[model samples]
Each structure stands twice: as C-alpha cells, then as structure tokens.
Target: MPKGEKVKAILFDANGMDREIAPLADVAHIPDKQIYWLIVSGQGAGKLPHPADGIDRAALRRGGVVVSDDRFCFSVPVAPNEGGHSEDAMILVVGRNWLVTCSDAPLSLTERYLEHDTGETLKGSLTAPALAVSLLLAHFDEFHTHLSAIEEKLDALDEQVFRSRQRHDPLNTLAVLRRRAARLRGLVAQHRSTIAALDRPDFGPAVCEEDRHHLTHLAGAYHRLVDTIDRTRDAVLSSYDLYATRVAQNTNRLLQRLTVITVGIGLIGALAGIFGMNFELALFKGEAPAFLMVVAGMAAIATVTLFMATRRS
Candidate 1:
C-alpha cells in the first residue's frame, strides 16, 4: 500500500465468513476463490493490486475505463459538492477474486456503502463484475437524488412564472437552471458510456442474471431522467418566450398612448401658428373672448383626440 493511504481489506466467502484482514502478500492462501475488497482513498492509486500494471496510472487518475487481458479499471463520478463541482476520484479495479477501489477524495456514498448490511454479504454470492455493477447501482441512487432536486427547482420556477403577479424577473433563475441541467446531462452521458462498455460481453467475465437485469433497468432509469430534463429545458424556454411577448405588448401600448398625446399637441400648435400669422381676421381682434375661445377649442381638441385613442385601444 502507498504510504499514508487509507486502505481497507475485507474477505467474504460462501461459508458466511466476514472479517477484515491485513494485506496478504499472496492470493493463493484462499482456496475457495473467496471475494476480497481492497478499498482505498486519497492517493491510494500509488499501490495498485498485483497483475494490474497494464492499467495506465495516468488514465486511472481521471474518470474513465480501461481494460486489459488480465484486469479492467474504471472510475465513477460522485455527486457534486456544495460548491457545485463534481470531483471524480472513485476508481475500481477488478481481478479474478479480488476487487480494488480508490478515490482521490473521501466519498459519502462510499462510506454509506461500507456501512450497509448488503455490503458485508455481497461477496457471498456476487462475482467481481457483478459487485462492480451493484456499486454503480448504488451510485445511480445518489444521482437520482440530484435529479429530484433539479425537479424541485424547475417546479418553483414554473410557479413563479405562472402564478406570481409581482414583476420579478426570472432571467437569472432560468440561466442557473439551464446550467444545472446542462451539467447533469454531460455527467449522465459520461456514465452512460461507461455503463455501455461494462455491459458488453467481451468487457470481462459475464455478470450474474440478476445483475444483468438490474443494469438494464438502471439504464432505462437514466433514459427517463434525460427525457425529463429535455422537457424541463423546453418548458423554461417557453416561459422566456412568454415573458418577451408580454414585454413587447406593453411597449407597443405605451407607444400608442404617446402617439395620441403627440397628435393632440400638434393640433394645438397648428391652431396657434395660424392665429399668430400676420393676417387680417375678424375673429381675433386681440380680445379676451377670442383668447378664451381659442383656449376652449384647444382643450376640446385634446379631449377628442384622447377619447378617440382610448376607444380604439
């Protein structure tokens, strides 16, 4: 094991024996082909299981899968942290009777899996390949929790858009939601590729029937999640379109009102210009009544223009 690496070894056999043991220098001591799990974390990749030298140390540093004749190694992505960044540190190495896993960081799901009752008994019946799939199934459970959170956020956004009367802008909220959905989609795609590779017949030893069924069902669940996100993205885009339409209508209405007021002012200007011209007219001899009459006429013109504009609206 690597210096300062947190490594744990557990042996489980068909005889119901379950116990932790120190790193055995030889694998031939176990005659029943018993299952062994060597779980490591935080720089544990420095000491890989024997016969796994073909597994590239560099590729194992990231989240991906690589298979050779004797061993296959892969990585699983954990859920994003509070900072909204996913750290890919979980790596798995499968051999004939032993499975080794490493993560650059401590994973919550890993802790939970270790504490679960099924974890102790899984080796009794499951092969190395099936055990790996089971771990992925557990990871999918975590992924679904994240999807549920996104659904709640989408529901709130839908409510705010449709039910609220306040002039609250949802642009920022929509942008955030879209980003979250996109990130999830990318992660799901990566997982899908990894799962597909594992499902291939030539990937490694055949998994048990139960595990194969579970994997198929899990793939279906992932597809459903992707479809749900697609619908959510569409719904958010529709809300944006609705908001823009409402804004355009409001602006056009305001312009219509301003146009009416402008025409009314022009009417008054035209009348004043005609009277101010140097022309001999009997109607306006610089009398107070003539001025009052002009004022009344201007007021009447403004009122008529406003009434006509409102009626049309």
Candidate 2:
C-alpha cells in the first residue's frame, strides 16, 4: 500500500446483510465463501497480493490505461457525472467469490451507493452480478440524462436552422453537436462491449437467472441509446448541409450586386477618361449640351446594367 493507505473490504450476502472486514488481512479468513467487494483506491492497490489465484493484481492496478488481457474479462470503468461528462477510468475484476474495483481516486459511484445505505432497502441482498448490473444502470442513467440534454439542444438548433430570419451561424453549433455525439457514441461502444462480455456464460462466475435478465434488459437499453446518438449525428449533418446551401445562395446574390456596381463604375471611369484627354474631342468642346448629353448617356448605361443584373438575380 502507499504508506498508510488501507483497502476497504465489504462483505455482503443475498439477505441484505453487510459486514465490514477490518484491514486487508481479514479477506483470507472470511468464514463463508460469499462475495466481497474489495475497493482499492489511491495507492491501496500496492497492498494487493499479486497473482492470487483468481485475482490478477497487475491487471487490476492498471486502472484502465492499457487494456487488460482479454481472457480475464476485466472492464474499463467509465465514471460519468451528472452532466454526463466522463470523470475518469477505473478497472473492475469480478471473481466467483470476490469483486475488486481499483482506481487512482475514490469513485463517486461507491460513495453514492454507500451514502444511500442500500443494503437493507432491498427485500433481498444483491448478488455480485446484480451489484455490477446496478452500478452499470446508475452510469446509464447519467448517460441517458446527458443524451436528453443534447437532444434538447438539437431541437433548439433545428428551430434556428429552419427559421430563415435567424442570421446566426449554425455551423459552429452543428460542429459542437457532432463532436458531442461522436464522443458519446465511443463511450457507449466501450460500455456495450463490456456488458456483452459480462453476459457471456464463460466470462465470469455463473450469475443467477434474475441477474441475466437484468443484463439482457440493460443491453437493449444500450442499443436504443446508441441508435438515438446515431440519429442525432445525422440531424447535425443535415443542419450543416442546409447552412451551407443558405451561405451559397447568399454569396450568389452578393456577387450579382457587386457585378452590377462594377459595371456602373467602369462606365463612369471610361467617360471620365475620355473627357480628361488633352485631345479636344467634340463631346468636350466647351458646349453645355454636349456635356449634358454625355452625362445622360453614362446614366442610361448604368441604369441598363443594373436592370439586367437585378432581373437575372
């Protein structure tokens, strides 16, 4: 252990009974062959016995940095906050009679679960698999709430996109939404794979039928969540496309206006050049009518150019 750090071990059974085993040494002397939750946080991992039969100390201590061996079926823990932002990674190692959770810091899930004192609330205590399932369900709740918020943002963005008067750029909003959707999808994929591995028969201890049923339901919920994310991504892309088309149309109109202005300015410049010449042209021969005629001709040419441009636009 890191200096004075101590690992917390909680022994529980299906009758909603819990007993705290003092210190790490008591783990080997438990009277019954029941499940215990060994929480090793901070440097507590240093105290764990290495390659102790069912427990792989090296894999557990890694804290989800590099993936553990596939044969061990360890899950890369993802802790999500109330806002659905993932906090940090941890590792879960489930065995036949013991469950080990390792992390660099204390986990919010453990704190919340402990604070609620959920032991006696249940008519019967939860099995190890059941406990794992509950933890996953908690994480998914946060994920679901986060997705709902994203969905709401998407709705607002959709309104802004469809309403032609809203001049603000939706591209930035779309880009942000796309990034969020992608990140959520990746997390969900990891979660899905972990759950799927747990559901398999050979991966871990044999879970009760009830636990299997719960896992099945959780898997279905995960699938639905992923589908929602996919749809959100598509919506963001569509909004981007609409925004691009609107920008293109605006650009075309702007170019048309600029072209008309350029033609008018070019005609004025040509007339000015002609009158500015040292050679005495008839149009500039000190006749007021001639000057007036030239001005009228320039005005007519400019008006015609503008008219044609406007008609085409």
Candidate 3:
C-alpha cells in the first residue's frame, strides 16, 4: 500500500502480498487465514468510516430497524441556555487482524493502532472491507462505553425527576432531555447496520462467527439501554404536563377571585351614583350625606368581596 493512503491491513513483503489482497489479487497477496484488526475514534462520527470505505460504512450502520443517526452515532449534550456540541459516540471492534473503527471525529482514529513503527502484523492480512467492519465494531464498543456513561447519568436523572421538581421551568428541561433521548435513539439504532454486516460479501477471515455474534449481542444491549431512556423521557414529559396543569389551575383560580372583586367594586360605584343623584328632591342628599353613603356602599362592596374570597378557600 502507498504511504499516504489509510489501510487497515497492509502487505509489504519482498513477496509483495497482503493477506486478504493476495487471495484476491497477484500483487500484495497475503496468506488466506491471517487475521488483523484496527480501530480509531474521535468526534463527528457522521464522517467516520470502516476500512475508511463507503460500502463498509454502510455495513457498520447495518441495523437501522430501531435506532437512528442522531441518537446512536452522533450526540450533542448541553443545556438549552448553554452552547456546546452534544454528539459524542465511540465504538469499534476488531479481531484477528480485522479492523473495526468508529469515529466521525475529524482526527485520525486509527493513529494509535498504527503507532507501532514496525510489525509484520501491521503489514495487514484481512480484506479491506472486513477489516473495516471489525475496526468499526471496535469503535462501536467505545460508543457503548459512552452510552453506558450516559445511561448512568439518565438513571440518576430518573431518580431526581421524582425526588424533586425539574425547577421553575420544567418544560425546557424536559425538552432538552427529550432531545438527548432522541439523539441516543439515533446512535443506538446504528447497531442494526453492524448486525447486517454479518452476511455481507466481504466477511474477512479476521471477522469470525464468534465476533459477529458478539456484535449482535452488543447491539441488543444498546437496545435495552435505549428503551430505558425512552421510558424515562416519557415520565418526564408526563410530569411536565402535570406541572403545567397545576399552574394553569392556580392561575384560573386567581383570575376568578379578581374578576368577582372588580364586579363588586363596579356595582358599589353605580349604587352610590344613583343614591347621590337624589332625583333633585333632596331625599336626604342636600347635605351631601352622599359621602357617608359612598363610604357605606364601598364598605358593603368590600365585605362582599371578602366573603367571596374566604368562601372559595
């Protein structure tokens, strides 16, 4: 392989053979059975690749029956009021010289695996695609670790959701958490692609049946974790709705009291106006006993308002 090109398996002997390529080609030919694995990780998994190839990338994303992109592979976590990237996923798997790398992060995830200056093993033996699957799986493993961590945090959140309210603005917190859960679902869903790779045309010798099974098992584990997150999210949403209802009820009750008070005051002012007019007949009005009458009317109105306020409570 050329120096600048990325290769999970390389065969650079005077014999001119890389294990997997040799089986399929004359130059860079390699033994039929040597296994190799490689892995790399970073952020922006959307750009990451297995064997750094498009087809393999598709395979690694095999099981889409459940999860989605935002949840499983890429995540951005931050408060609504804060600014930051939320997407973070790490997982890659490799065995027997196969490569499985997961990381869309802009940096080279395979750098560490390639750190060893010289090893015949580093020369490469597995098919490009198979190596890609294996390495991609390794990346998924890292992703699983990250998800596990998230799960722990969510578990704690679940407890708190019940122990104390989500704060003065529960809806916003619920929205943020709901967004996080959605991202998780997308990330976990990609394992479906990983599972599908088991039957792809390029199953390199490095990717053993056992390894494939392990990948499937990992996918299942992620499914369970996602389910839990979803359930928790539902609870949070319900709690948010409940809180909103209570607030609305309290507001309505307040408005009702204020409405009755205003009407009572209005009626008192009208009655005082009528009594003071006296029809110009001086019906105890000439001395402006009107002031006393007004005071009495206001007091009566106040009493009525007070009675209503008290009775409701």
Candidate 4:
C-alpha cells in the first residue's frame, strides 16, 4: 500500500477459485460475497488504511485487540524462531468478506500455511472468521514446535546435569530456558484471551455455529498449551534444584578432604613443637637416633590420621 511495504493479496471468488491480486487494488469492484485476504509485512502497518474507526495503532503495535459491530482487529505475537522468541506482533483485521494481516516481519508459518495442500482444500470452506481461525491455528502449531524443541533441550540438560561426571553448571542454560518458556506462556495466554473474545456471543460479524465450534476447540488447545509450558518451567526449576544439590555435595566432599589435610598438618606441627621444647630429657638430648625416632613418630601419626579420614562407612 505504501513505499517499503510488502503486501500480498489473494482473492477468493464466489466460485471458490482463488487468485493473487494487487494488494492495494480497488476492492469496491468485487462482489460483496467474495473474500480477499491481504498480508502486509514490514513498517507498512502504520500506513495501511484503517479497517475500522477507533482502532488504536499503538495498541496494535503493542499487542491488543478491538472488536466492533461488523469487524474485529487484533495484534498477536509471532514466533518465527524455534527458540520461541517472538520478534513482532501480527495484526489481523477481519470484516464480513475480507481479512487483512499485517506484521513487522515476514511470517514463515503464514507462508507454510498458504503453501500447504490444506490451504487449497480450505479455500472452498473459507470465510473471513474461518480463515482467521486457521491462521491462528498455524501460529499455535509453531508454538508447539518450539515447545517440543524446548522439551528436548530440557532432556539433554537433565542428562548432562545428573548422568555425566563432568562438572557442568546448567544454571545459565536453565535460566535461559525458563525465560523462553515464560515468554511463550505469556504470548499463548494472550492468544487464549483473544480466542475467548472471539468465542463470546456478542463478538462481531457474528461468528457462525461452525466457526464458533472451531473457536471452542482452539480455546481448549490453548489451555493445554499453557499447561504444557507450566510443566516445562517446573521441570527447569527441578533441574536447578538438582544442580544446586550436586554442587553442594561436591563442595562438602572438597571441604572434607581439606579438613583432613589440615588435621594431619596440625598433628605434625604439634610433634615438632613438642620436640623443640627446651627440657633436658633423654629424648631431646639424644643425637641422630632421637631425631630419627621423632621423624618416625610424626610420620606414623600422619599416616593414621589420613587413613581414618579416608575410610568410608
């Protein structure tokens, strides 16, 4: 619609045939029953025509939704990476016969959704609300794929922390995973609320019974997604606990060895101190034989102390 903006539009006619069209072409020529889907990428969202009055551009950028009598508009976080980092918000505005999607970056999931065979089959059954639901479902699928990757990482971390002998500190790695999971959970929660709003009786353009059923199912799926994220976070926390416990145990073992060495050194120092006393006894007055006996006694005491220290229960 504007310079530096990338837009793609697909028009679905009453006969169910779909074709690409100029993104900013005059849609007034199309019949009211036909549907057009517009996908706009980059800094163009602010320049695109407003789908309805009272839609806040700031809210759309920050991730929010507004519903009206004939249309609804919402912005949702899109995670294009397997790391579950949401780079931008995807804004969608849907009316009776048209849907407009805008994002700051290209959405790979959207591309895949369009290229898949499912997209062809769904063309015949498509309505504005149904298409919106399908797009949202694709986003959820991306989230699931990201979550699956996270779960695998958690498993690997668990193995490294508990099974391996190498000293590994998973605190940093665990912290990162926890943060990602938390962010993912927040985005999914936002989507869950958006779906709930769509499922409400007063939601506009008035969702049909079939679309309403899909929304219900999507809501249930979002609930499960939230639960899965929570469980993954708990696992991270538990791994942290295990890691802390292992570190403490290793520290105690080190301290125990140091204590033994200190005790042995202390015993040898005491023997030397006793021998250095200025008493004129036969032990102190004797020459090399007495010195040899002192050395022998000190060595015996040090050996016994070390032996006792190292003995296991």
Candidate 5:
C-alpha cells in the first residue's frame, strides 16, 4: 500500500469464520455468498475502487449520506481532537454482500473490532447490513468513551474551581470544555435523522430480521448517546456558574479588605492634617505634652477604626 493509503479486508465465510484477505482484492470478484468488510484509511478511499453505484462522492466528502435501491452510503464523524473539534469523518458504503469503510486515519475502534469480538457474536454468516450496524454501534461506543473522559476532566475542574486557592480564572478551561461538548453533541445529532431513516421500511438494503432488530437497537442507542451528551453539556454550564460565583466571592473579600485599609489610613491622615495647622493655640504651648497627646489620640482613633473594620457584618 502507498504511504497515504492503507487497506484491510476481512472475509467472512459460510461457517461464520472471518479471515484476512488481500488489501487490494477487488470487491466485484468476491463471491456473493461470502460477506466482506473493507477498511480504507488515509487517502485510500480515493485510490480504491468505488464500493457501490449512486454513491455521491461529493456528499461523502462533505459528511452526508445517500441511500438507494442497491446501496447505503453515509459519513460519520471520527473520534474528536482534544480541543473538541471533529476534523474528519469516516465514510461507509454498504452493498448487498460487501461493506466498505474509509476514513482520513485508521480507527482504533475498527482495529479492535477486527481483532477481537466485542460482544457482537456472529451466530450465522454476517450480512452487510449487520456489519454496518455493528460498526455504527462501535462508533457510538467511542462517543460514550469520549464523553466519559470529558466527564472526568469536568470532575477535576470541579475540584480546581472549589478547592484550589490558585488565583486563576477557570473560564478559559471551561470554555474549551463547553465547546468540546457542543461539538460532540452536534456530531452525534447529525446522524439522528439518518439513523432513524435506517429503521424505515423503505430503506434500500434488504435487511434481514436480525439486522432490523439490531438497527432498531442502534437507533435507541443513538438516542441515549444524545441524552448523555446533553447531560455533559449541562454539567459544563453548571461548572461555569460555580466558577462565576467563586470569582464574585473572591472579589467581594478583596474589596472589603481594601475598604478597611482605606478607612484606617484616612482617619490617621485627618488627625495629622489638623495637628500641622498654622494656628498657634494654647494647647500647643506645652510642646512635648501636646505632641504626645496628639500621637496618643491618633493611635486611639486608629485602634477604634481597626476594631470596627475587622468586625464581620
């Protein structure tokens, strides 16, 4: 395979045993009785032969789906980046006996599904629609994993917001998380109509009874996934509110301290200003005694002011 192109083919025989085949094997040449899955990574989608007729290449590139009598084609978002941006989508084209998946990069979920049976047991031969649903469900699992990781981060952020004495605002961090949650929610929602369409009786693929059940189950799973994302978003918003409250409390405490200091200084300055006046009064005749009296009086005033300022309201 070329540097930007990689392919993996898995052929499932009549006995339900899956084995690897040549990466470049032609789908048209494969036997109709056997079901095969082709995964193309990087720029492999462009290099490989098109999987089915009536597939809109433009729509596939733009993260859209096309369903027809002979094929079902759609694009789903891949795992998101740390910054919450979904930079690419994986395209899936399903035919009667074959299924082809293409993405900008190799997916670990796909590899794991290929390497080990992740509870999706193959009782009989795997049908193309069943394989497609399985892969779709696997992608939904990725969404849950990603959200769980986000939830952990939110937990850590909660600790930082409430317990840590660090004087940094968590708004930026919270904003990033909010954006990530929104992006995830948007990506999951994009498939809502498409997934619902799969359950419709008029859907193109000749879905088997078992596959239809799986498809219905997949729809339900998608709904749950959306609900999870919504809750995650709510958590982020709640964190934002908590952070704002913390900031307001800190600001109030700082202002109170500053007000106390200002009041104390003003009282002492007023006393000093009066003593420095040019008017020579009888009290100034006793130089040492008068200076001592002024000092004591200022001290007394400062003590009173300090006492009043320190008292909690």
Candidate 6:
C-alpha cells in the first residue's frame, strides 16, 4: 500500500491535452502537485452472503471524499461505512504518487476519457495529479452530452403535443421523463458541490492559472446543465396539461352526442307506452286493431318530432 501526500494546492489544466489511464487497486503514494479525491466503500456494503471461512465475498459500498494522499487506487473498491454502493463509484489520490478513482455508479464520463486516442497520455504526464485533473475535466463533456439529450427529448415531446393532430396520454410519457430528469438533476447538483470543492481556493486549491480556468469552466457547465433540466421539466408539465385539455374536450363532445340520441329514443318510447294501455274507449271498442294501428302512426310521428328537436339541439 502507498502512503498519501500532504494536502496542498489545486492543480489546473490549461490545455485540453487530458489523457486516460487504467485504474489500480490501491495507491502507493501521492505527489505533492495533484488533488486526491477519494472514493472509499462503506462498512456494510455488498449483498453477497458471508462464507463460513470469514471471506468478505461481497462488493463494498462506496463512500466518497477528497483525500490528499492514500494507498488506495482509483479503481480499488473499498468497504463502505453503510450500504452497498451501486449508485456511485470512487476515486482517490495515492499518497503523492498517483490519482486513483473508483465508483459504484456507472459514470459515462469515465468511459469517455478511457475512449480517448492517447492511451499513453496519462502515462506520459509530467505529474500524475495534474494528469488526473485533466482526465476529470475531459470527462465533463459526457455530463453535458447527457444533459443536452434530456433537453432534446423534452423539446421533441413538446412539439408532438402541440402540433400532432392525433391525441394521446401525455401524462404517462411526461411523468416518466420528468422522473428521469429529476434523478439526473439531483446527480448533477451533488456533483457540482464536489467539483466546486475541488476548485475552491481553500479546499483542493488549484495550483496554476490553467487548473483554475478548467475548474471555472466545469462550474459553468454544471449551471447550464441544471438550467436546461429545469426548462425541460417545465416543458413536460406544459405538454401534459395541453394533452389533458384536448382529451377533456373530446370526451365532452362524445357525451353530448350520446345524450341527444338518448333523449330522442326516450321520447318515442314514452309515446308508445302511453298508447299501449288497454283502457276501454267508445272509439276503440269494435275496431280494436284499427285503433292500435292509429296509435302506431302517432308514435311514428312523435319519433320524427323528437329526431328534429335533437338535431337542432
């Protein structure tokens, strides 16, 4: 295991020549020039059952903090203080020697850096800490990508609701999308603080002008992403409301037609029921069949009258 270096100033990245490197299990040491953002696991992490031989055969829960120097590697998953960390992974500064990073959560930003062409960029760096900061800055582009995607989806949904001649339930789609947005929103908000802490004058404290600029840019990106999420949420709600109104209007029109038909049918039935009575009458005595026929004619006449009334209504 490596020993950690004393915490000092923040390292900056002026040029975008950030590189990616493979993570190690634990840090051997940290250099004085780098930042040590640590990702340790919680004590009670992992869901695996314990073995009789006392083997901790479970994944460790993640607990994140900034470390000045440590022996742990960035990829080294540690035992967390509490639950299994499937949400976020961790990163650490290996005692003035290397920058280690690990995470319980799936981070696309990490993937982005790893995909860069320069497999040797991280390895070729003059200072390991500075290299780590560069990789971290490069990773921010991924967050921005996700944020933009969410916004685009919301905008598309808004167009469908407003312009589509066909109507559908906007609530279902909107609700789900809103929830996802909220989740990302929370994640970004939390990340902003962490990154800000890295850039703070007193905290990790940037070393040069370049690192300071990179940190500032990262903060700005966070603000922009957050604003986009908020606007998307508003658009989702607006689309839902508009869809609701259209649905209500369609329902009311259908009911109005049904009501008219019902009234018409009721009038004709009433006329027939009244005439159907078997009460004795001088005119109906001998010509009972003829009297019934006349009653039928009157019912027909009533039906026509009811039809016209309903039509005009």
Number of the top-ranking candidate, with TM-score as the measure: 5
TM-score of 5: 0.77
Q: lDDT of all the models against the reference?
A: 0.69, 0.64, 0.47, 0.73, 0.76, 0.49
lDDT of 5 at 17: 64
**Taking the tens digit of each residue's C-alpha lDDT, what string does model 6 give over 103-203?**
33434454454455333233332444445556655554544555566567667767775675546565666777677666665655556556556556654
Estimated TM-score for each candidate: 0.70, 0.63, 0.49, 0.76, 0.77, 0.52
lDDT string, candidate 5, 92-149, tens digits: 8887778888777888878887777623345226668878888888889888988998
After TM-score superposition, what is the CA distance of residue 67 in candidate 6 from its true location, in Å? 6.7
Cα RMSD for predicted model 6: 9.8
Candidate 5: give the clashing pairs.
Answer: none
Error (Å) of candidate 1 at residue 41 is: 1.0
* 29-83: candidate 3 lDDT, tens digit per residue: 3254544333334333243344333323334433222122211221211111112
Model 4, 19-110: lDDT tens digits are 67776445445565567788877775465553433465556666555777777788777874656666688888887667888877778867
Write out the backbone clash pairs for model 1. Answer: none
Query: How many pairs of residues collide in each model?
Result: 0, 0, 71, 0, 0, 48
- Give per-model CA RMSD: 4.8, 6.4, 10.4, 4.3, 4.1, 9.8
Positional deviation of residue 138's Cα in model 2 after best superposition, in angstroms: 1.7
Off by over 4 Å in 5: 1-4, 12-17, 23-35, 42-56, 62-65, 68-70, 118-126, 269-286, 303-313
What is the clash tally of candidate 4?
0
User: On a 0 to 100 scale, what is the lDDT of residue 168 in model 1?
Assistant: 62
Clashes counted in candidate 6 amount to 48
Better of 3 and 4 by TM-score: 4
Better of 5 and 6 by lDDT: 5
